[model samples]
Target: MNPLVLPLVLPGVYAPQEDTALLAGALSEEPLPPGADVLDVGTGSGALAIEAARRGTRVTAVDVSWRAVCTARMNAWMAGVPVRIRRGNLFAPVRDRSFDLILTNPPYVPAPTGSRPPRGPARAWDAGGDGRFVLDRICREAPTLLRPGGVLLMVHSALSDPGRTIEHLRGSGLKASVTRRHRIDFGPVLRGRREWLRERGLLSDADEKEELVVVRAELPV
Candidate 1:
């Protein structure tokens, strides 16, 4: 797949990493109706949301970081796509709305320390301890926001347990499956946690790669 071109990335905002590309590639293959309502949770540089808008979907993007929100808004404007950008954690800003599709590349890197999510750029990737801090919430809450037949596409490291994601979505009554996977070299955060992760049995000492998986979960019509 050709790389999906992205707009400007503001400092402190998450850029379009491998996980983002994997999810975007899956999004490109989806059969979306014109004007389909789409929501992008934790939208960083607005890459996925803007791409959805390019496909004729009405897209709304939400993020917990003000910088991310601003970056997304600017990117949407630069891309000449009308995307509704809001600032809030996970699904809070869209609690009362329903969407035909949802996209997210949430924080899934296992942090070795406290339960509190760390501040700064690390917030984009550091998930407390088990790395389910954001993923679990998305699985539990996203199904509630989907319209009948709506789909949610999310990407995360295999270290975070893609099976758990599928299970959680299935438990919520959505049919879910892993749609794509890509093995890539460890990024700085993971590199820093390599030993700690190995000690926790989440990673092997010789492992230098992480598998990123894109999950597709859909509501039945």
Candidate 2:
């Protein structure tokens, strides 16, 4: 089931979009044992966390934004699921704790700027140039957060280079690959930056859509 069908999205918090839905769908297909330990990194509105909880998994969610943390907490409360929500950057709030599953839909939109916005709604999508700012960190850190046989289900834009993510995860000793892909029309954010993206060779002149991918990485048991 989709977890964020009607989540309470605070003004500065990110609402569930395509990436969230994509990640949730992948979570639904994962073989989560009852009461499995799960982590939702960057759980903006607790969508994936709620979904995991619905499947009878114990979920702990973390986000960098306080508003997002609060939004997720409230949404999970409304969903009648028990999710431990914390405010911190990726992996910081859950140090030393490993999980059977980790879900993330982090900021992957490549932006003209080199740094993420310090605050505001833009923080949800304004990733640094090349869009590897948060993605690279997750690739490096998430593997360590996974238990033996644990799986990471992450969704990001093709513009961020899913192949690089796979390689990074594999180098970390996890078996990784793209599990799903979806083509979507450029949203307002991408459309407004079309010219800049084209100049950077990240987008083609004829390309009107962006491809989002779900990269699944699993640790060996």
Candidate 3:
């Protein structure tokens, strides 16, 4: 992988990672309409949102963390892009708005089940034990935020059950599929939870890699 050429990424905001790059690459392949409305859920540091704006789309980015919101705003300004950055969880800020494209790289690291995700830096990852804390919510709520024929491009670790995401999107009447997949060694968070993951039977002691998948879902026009 080449070095990630990114705008200034401030502390406390989620920096772009492998999943972010995969989703961004997938976003580049999308055939967007002129001045399409785009939503970047959980837009930490506004990476995906800025990329969408660079593609000439009108972008809105939202995050629950004040630090993240500030960081994203700074990044957008530095990139000379007009991304509407808001502070909210998931789709709350844009409840009534619909988008032509929705891009996300939500938290998906498996943590202990039933334990609340930690605040601070861990908030960027640290999903519940199954790693679906954020992914499930995104799959459930994101489709409703899509305009007709709109698309959602979400990247998450396959350890979180990518199949379940496809099923949920399909159940919601969107055509969903895995558009991209890549195997990468575990990052810090996952590496720290390596033993726990094995205990949960989600990983094996010999496994050092995890698969990241970009799930694309399109609503019927």
Candidate 4:
């Protein structure tokens, strides 16, 4: 129940990076209304949902992790706000539903093979080869989940073209662009990500370097 619990040790405990948490908190400064309806996709730690709720918004958050789902709802309760947390990949839980604001920090790690992945399937952090697996799927699905004139806020690693993300949203019939950025040591789990790509001859860079991007996409009516 404590915020300091071991996220790595706990099942479905997605310990977000410091920058991720910071980015979530910063959403209040954006143009979102004080009481807009919000959806937090891939609600790791439910930080974004909690933050938006704290800002007086009604939030419905989702994650593939059962523990995360429960944790998110509980975290919202503990924070003295109401949030509907559900278990589903991408937009399954909220099909046919729309939100005024959508936020996601998806699992961008590239799991080239089924045999690989730190936590395996259902953890919601494993994206298939190229890491674009989840990113691409989410982009394609976001428009339908967003309400008319709604905004889709996303945070993903620069390891996979941030520009491509913007392009995807733009091409998907939405207005999109980069809103923020920062870098992090992708941790030991992704240590072999580039190597896996290299083994397949997809990556040629000898040095490891990447950035994470925060993008804002909107479904303008």
Question: What tens-digit string does per-residue lDDT give for candidate 3 at 142-169?
Answer: 9889999999999998899999999999
lDDT of 2 by residue, 15-101 (tens): 888888888889889998899999999999888888899988899999999998889889999999899999998999888899999
lDDT of 2 at 112: 81
- The TM-scores of all predictions, comma-separated, are 0.97, 0.96, 0.96, 0.84
TM-score leaderboard ranking = 1, 2, 3, 4
**lDDT, each prediction:** 0.91, 0.90, 0.88, 0.74
Q: 91 in model 1: Cα distance from truth in Å? A: 0.8
Per-candidate count of clashing residue pairs (backbone under 3 Å): 0, 0, 0, 1
Model 1 stretches with alpha carbons more than 4 Å out: 1-3
Which regions of candidate 4 fall more than 4 Å away from where they truly are?
Answer: 1-9, 114-122, 198-206
lDDT of 4 at 121: 36
Please state the error at residue 70 of candidate 3 in Å.
Answer: 1.1
lDDT of 4 at 18: 49
Instruction: State the lDDT at 39 in candidate 1.
Output: 96
In model 3, what is the error at residue 164, expressed in angstroms? 0.4
